[model samples]
Target: MRMVFRWFGEGNDQVPLQHIKQIPGVEGIVWALHDIPAGEPWPTDRIKEVKQQADQFGFHIDVVESVNIHEDIKLGLPTRDKYIKHYITTIKRLAEVGVKVVCYNFMPVFDWTRTELFEKLGDGSTALFFDNEKIKDIDPMELVEKISSNTSVTMPGWEPERLKSLAKLFEQYEHVTEENLWSNLQYFLEKVIPVAEQHDVKLAIHPDDPPWSVFGLPRIMKNRDDVERLLNLVSNPYNGLTMCSGAFGADPKNNVPDMVNEFIDRIHFAHIRNVKNKGNKSFIETSHRASDGSVDICDVVKAYHENGFTGYARPDHGRHIWDEKCRPGYGLYDRALGIMYLWGIWDSLERSKKVEA
Candidate 1:
């Protein structure tokens, strides 16, 4: 497995590429033009700007976290065609900059939901927490305010401009069911996957965080069966998954290692993080250590190593350790620590193979 670090960009992220470069095994940056809104075509010059930044640090910009899907595309509106046309152009441009995999999600209304941005852990370090009970009671707008109030940066999926029409977006989705979401997603993949294949870019969809519905929004990409159905929807090698462990592992039903084994080939990019399930669909992001959270991260890495995974893998969301004043989960300290933990497990696996041989 090849390691990469997600950097929001020069100005948007607190973590610098130099700091990312210091991480032992990280060879690339998982990035995107965060300033650009969803559905808009990413400008060629803007794409080149990020390339120049990564090039300066000798980091390959192989994977982009998203070219976010517009709500029109998800809602299956006629205006979607216009946005999709723009999306196709963006893909072609990203290909020019050497991006290999593009990760995007289809979670309606909200990309990922959480009650508390920083809930204290036993170690006194804080992490992103999801309170299942509170989510049901809290208003979506109130949740939006809560998230916005905490972070200076615009949280992905919870962008203010997008949420401006929050009630309208929810009203539009009132009639849209899970099946409708699946159909809309299929419509999207059919148009873009071919372009992705032609440009040698794999389109990877991140599973819904929490792997379940939030605020009564329809969530189709939530579990093993959901992932299986999505892959089968297009049935092409270019059509792939981002394979986020924290999202899938939060659900006790998902055997993460088993899922890794089954879908390793289809996984083009991996988000390897851990989440401790608090029960009844709530979880808090934890350090990447296998024992620290419910996910068997050690075995998950071993599965990828044993499968000879050549794709990009990144240490996903981590605790806000060391009093780091940074993006909620994109902090440098814990993620760097997490990467080392992953390397520890993977390097040991390699040595064990050698000893066995």
Candidate 2:
């Protein structure tokens, strides 16, 4: 596995590329033009600029976390074609700059939902928490306020412009059902996957955060069967999955290692984080260590190793350890620790394979 770190950009992220470079085994950055709104074509110059920065640090910009999908595309609105045309242009440009994978999600209204960004754990370190019962009672607007209140660092899915028209956005999804979402997603993949294939860029769709619907929104990418249907829908190597453990682990039914084994080839990027399933559809992101969370992270890595995975992997959301005043889940300390844990597993596996030989 080729490990990468997620860096928001020069001015946006608290963690610097130099710090990321210090992490052993991290070779690249998973980045995005966060200032750009969804649906618009990314400026080629801006893409080159980010690449230049990474080049300065001697890190490859091989993967981008998101090129946010416009609500128009998800809702299958009349204007979707226009946005999709722009998306194709963005993909072509990213490929030109050596980006191999683009990770995005189809979660409506919100990309990921959480009741608390900093729920203090027993160790006094805080992590992103999701309470199943609490989410049902909380008002969507109130949740939006809680997540968006901090204006310094922009949340990926909860952009200010999108939330400014929250009521209207919800209205657009009023008639969208799960089937509608699947059809629209298929429509999107059909148009873009070919372009991605032509440019050697893999379009990786991140599973719905929590792997379930939130706030009455339809979520189609939530379970193993859902992924089976998704891969079959497009049936192309270029159309793939991001294979996020924390997202799928929220649903206890998802055996993350098995999913890794089954779709190993189709998975172009891996978000290897752990989540302690709190039962009844609630979870909290945890340390990448196997004992700290419910997901068997070791087995997950073994599946990838056993399957001969050579794709990009990154340490996903981590605890806000060491009193780090950073983005809710994108803190540097715990994630760097997570990377070492993963490297330990991967290295041990490699040694065992050589011994067998």
Candidate 3:
């Protein structure tokens, strides 16, 4: 596995490239054009700028966390073709700078939902938390309010422009069912995946966070069968998955390690973070350690190694430790520590294989 880090660029993130360089095994940055809204084609000049910055630190910008798909594409609106053209343009531009994998999601309105951004843990360190029951009772507006309350840090999925127009966005999806979502996603893949192939860029769809419906929005990328259907739909090696443990682990039955082993061939990117299942479809992001969360992170990491995974991997969503005033899950301390923890497992696996040889 080639380790990567997620950096929000120069001013946007508190964790600097200098700090990320200090991490033992990280080789790249999973990044995006944050200021650009969905549906806009990222300018080639801007892509080059990010490339220059990463090159300065000797980190590859080979993986982009998202090139946010316009809601129109997900809704299959008449204007989708226009937006999809923009998306294709962006993909070609990213490829110019050596980006091999582009990670994105198909969840409507919100990309990922959570009730609290900083839930206090037993160790006094805080982490992103979700309470499923609480979500059902609360209004989507209230949840947005809570998530957006952190004005200093921009939440990944909850872009201000989208949040400001929530009512219209929800109304647009009011008629969209699970099947509709699947159809729309297939339509998107059919259009973009071919272009991605032309550019030699792997289009990796991130699994829906929580791996279930939120706010009654249709969620199709939630499980193993869902992934199976996705691969079959596109039927291209470049059309792949960004298998995230925390997202799938929300459902206790996900069998994350098995997923790593089963879909090893098509998983182009990996987000290896652990989450403690809070019961009844709720989970909280936790330390990458196996004991700290429900996911068997060691087994998951080992599975990746055994499968000969040379693709991009990252230690996703670390807790905010040492009173660090950083992005909730993108903190430097816990994630840097998580990298060492992951490397410890990966290196030991390598040693065992050498001994066997």
Q: Can you list the residue pairs that collide in candidate 3?
A: none
RMSD of 3: 0.8
lDDT of 3 at 329: 88
Local distance difference test, each candidate: 0.92, 0.93, 0.92
- Per-residue lDDT tens digits for candidate 2, residues 1-357, read 999999999889999999999999999999999999888899999999999999998999999989999999999999999999999999999999999999999888789889999898999999899998999999899999888775469898888877888999889899999999999999999999999999999999999997888888999999899999999989999989999999998888899999998999899999999999888888888999999999999999999999999999999999998888999999999999999999999999999999999
- Order the candidates by lDDT, highest first — what do you get? 2, 3, 1
Tell me the tens digit of each residue's lDDT in model 3 across 167-254.
9998998989999989988999999998999999999999998788888889998999999999999899999999999999989989
Tens-digit lDDT track of model 1 for 179-276: 99999999999999999999999999999987888888899988889889999999999999999999999899999889889998899999999999
Runs of candidate 3 with Cα error greater than 4 angstroms are none
Instruction: Score every model by TM-score.
Output: 0.99, 0.99, 0.99
**Candidate with more favorable, higher lDDT: 1 or 2:** 2
Q: Best lDDT goes to which candidate? A: 2
